[model samples]
Target: MKTVPIQIALPEDEYADQLAFLKKWDDGPKPPGWELTPKAVVVFICGGSGLRLENNQRMDIAPKFIGDRSLVERCVVTLAGARGLLLVGEPGTAKSMLSELLSAAICGTSALTVQGSAGTTEDQLRYGWNYGMLLAEGPSEKALVPSPVLSAMRAGKVARIEEITRCQPEIQDSLVPVLSERRIAVPELGDYSVPAREGFCVIATANLRDRGVSEMSAALKRRFNFEHVDPIADKKAEVALVKSRTQRAIADAQALIDVDDAVVDTLVTIFKDLRSGITEEGWSVAKPTTVMSTAEAVAISTSISLAAAYFPDSGAQLALIPGHILGAVRKDDEKDTERIIAYFDKAIQRRANANPNSPWAILWDNRHGIS
Candidate 1:
């Protein structure tokens, strides 16, 4: 019998070629246990656009985090020091993506991670019991279940914790001693301690609007250097991201849909208007409480392409963006639907009338199904 194998590689494993290219280019001293120099790491996150090689060949490194290079620099430097790095932001601001990119660049493996949630147990963060081994060998080292945090501590690798605030505050504080003391105390095994090797650090994310989140304790807060990850502020940049991501999705699905540039622009404009409670032309539109993020824009853009792919001859009517956004906005508050409706009447329709035969007008025409 023949068996098939599944290959699931981390970002580092997948991008070995780029990593090798960067290693060859950079000669700066790296911190202990880092895979790339600080400059090279920066290049890895913020693309080395139009960068020159040793042979004078142009090299283009694809950027992961579409924000400030200095912010990325600060994050990398934080993990190189004593304090743990905490990424705080609104949902879909690429906090997790930034963390994974940082982890892959620094540790050579982005696999050591703990996803924090309301149901996350203390054992998940620290250690757990192997009941079978415990029953056989009475509280021995063999009976201990090592967690991601413990594994990183022992190996001196980067460990990630997603949605840290979602975890109960008491459960979250379990890291105070582990971080400050640089060790995990396992009392069940005769006060066993797992000392953190050099370069071991924690990168955690806290969503501003996460459900059932407890306020982080002051002591725990002191142990981490917090960085705010804001959404993309530029329109062209956001549109480019949406197009790139949606095109990738279309290719993955083997869909031959070309998401129009005009459609992409209109969708992004709607999101920005709804998010800021004001139009590009200075109209006061009521803001929706729902997060109208760039990630959401990418998702909606991809979804629209997929819709075009599946539905026969649906490419002609690619302006049902209002309908798609209607679903996206009504998440947190039902009253947000009214705000969306008001936006159609006040801003979008006016734009359609003002800029006749454009995608805005087409989207305005499709506003009927939004309700």
Candidate 2:
């Protein structure tokens, strides 16, 4: 039997070629322990058009994050200066994805990461001990187990802390000394300490929705430069991104049907309207409690596309839009189901009335999916 490949690849592995290309593409001075110059790193995330090598080979860098280039630049600048960078944003706005891309481009790997949660202990962010080794040989260097942050300090690479606010306040505060002093003191080793290498820095992400869950102390907040990531504001750009990503997802799944662009456009419009509580036509709509982010839109599009591919005779792809929207909206709150139905009764129904033959009409007709 043929072996199955992994479903998802890390940023470092997925963008290995692009990272290598950027490294050779720019020979400019880079900060200590950085693989790419700050300029190249920005381009790697924001993308560049018409880039060429000495051989005149055209290599266009694809845009990974669909947000402000300025924000990405600020992040690079912070890391370049050896300061911690905190990216705070609404859920599903690709904050964690941006962190991974930056780490992969700066170093050669994005695996040095600590996922923050309520159960996260200080040892996960600092260091732990190997009980076996500790018991057998007493507290020694060999008995010490370094966390991802410690590993990054030793390797002079970027380390990521995802959902930093999800961790307990006290546990989160453990990073204060590490970020400020740039060293992890090991009392077990008798005054020994692991100083952060020249390139070592941190990139942490926190969701605005998680504010009350585990608020960071003022001292911890002061240690990092905060950047607020917002949702994509341009409709055309978001639609294009959703279509591109959905098509790519279908291709990755080896699906047989082509993605319906009209379906994707309609789906994204609904998401934007629900997300912003306002329609493109200047109509007011009740926003769902759940985040109707572009990432969610892409997932719904991919699901609808794959459904069409697998069940070709079920119905037209456009007909699947309302059901998927209902599914996406009903995730966080049960009342959101009523909100979605009202949206269908208002914005979608109006669109259907405006043009009875358009995709909106199909969505309006299938509005019963919400109920």
Candidate 3:
């Protein structure tokens, strides 16, 4: 028998499988044009009790991200009001993931998104011209091309603008009237305007460390609720997230390997300590000037797992972690390697001496990657 791997589905598709269950679980009050009640939306993100399928079997849902349940609820509420929701945080903290999840749950589709960048133009947020048609027909409605935001407005669905701060201030402000008057005027198309529908809303994400992010104008800022997404705080939860996500990635790659929990723990520890500027032994290690987010931990863990899967019997290959850490820590600056070496000297060496039998200590013994 041939093993046919399952195709990865979108978040909306995943939730669609449970849409009936969501409706049955809470048929209470819902906002206009919402797929589920606000209460059920809460259950969708934070996970909940009492859901079943038509087969009379219990249906359990997993909470997507580990964060404050109240935070997710606030996002849902903001969308219900058809206002803008802005998620700002350091890179790799899952700000985009949160937006996608909320959009998937409420609107049932998260595909209407515009990736904001320095080169992003106002036409992307408002409307663009079908130049061929414009030249032939002389700027009629047929020549107007709607942007993702315009489409979301016309459809009354969620419109996601990722890394909004990366866009120029003038381009970013193109969204002001969209959120304020809930409309987009296409002057070139001869008095045509696109009005947002009942469920129309926008979700945007920005990185705190972004240098090219021209400060959002006060007019744009006043139109949206800003949420600061922090990095994973709990050590145990962070470890579990990395382990589970890395395992999923490995399995998705169709590679068979059991990434030792001890290895996962050490990786998470180093990332958290470096990110927090403190060591497990409370030693002050020089922090790398990089955004050491949990996503980076997942990447390093998955890479190690893939390597172990391919070279199960290679002892040296299994101990190549220090090399991997050295690589993961140095993103943009060569000086970051010095921070890792200094950390190895002050913290890793001390910790290894304290716990000589642990997996972390084994990793510490391989610190010559920097030397």
Q: Indicate the TM-score of model 1.
A: 0.95
Per-residue error (Å), model 1, residue 191: 3.4
The whole-model lDDT of each prediction reads 0.86, 0.90, 0.84
Model 1 per-residue lDDT tens digits across residues 164-264: 99899999999999899999988887778899998799999999998533388999999999999998888888888888988987877778878778778
Per-candidate Cα RMSD to the true structure, in Å, reads: 2.0, 1.3, 2.5
Instruction: Name the best candidate (by TM-score).
Output: 2
TM-score of 2: 0.97
Question: Clashing residue pairs, candidate 1?
Answer: none
Candidate 3 clashing pairs? none
What is the Cα root-mean-square deviation between model 2 and the actual structure?
1.3
Q: Candidate 1: what lDDT?
A: 0.86
Better model by lDDT, 2 or 3? Answer: 2
Candidate 3: segments with Cα more than 4 A from true spot = 1-8, 49-56, 212-214, 316-318
RMSD of 3: 2.5
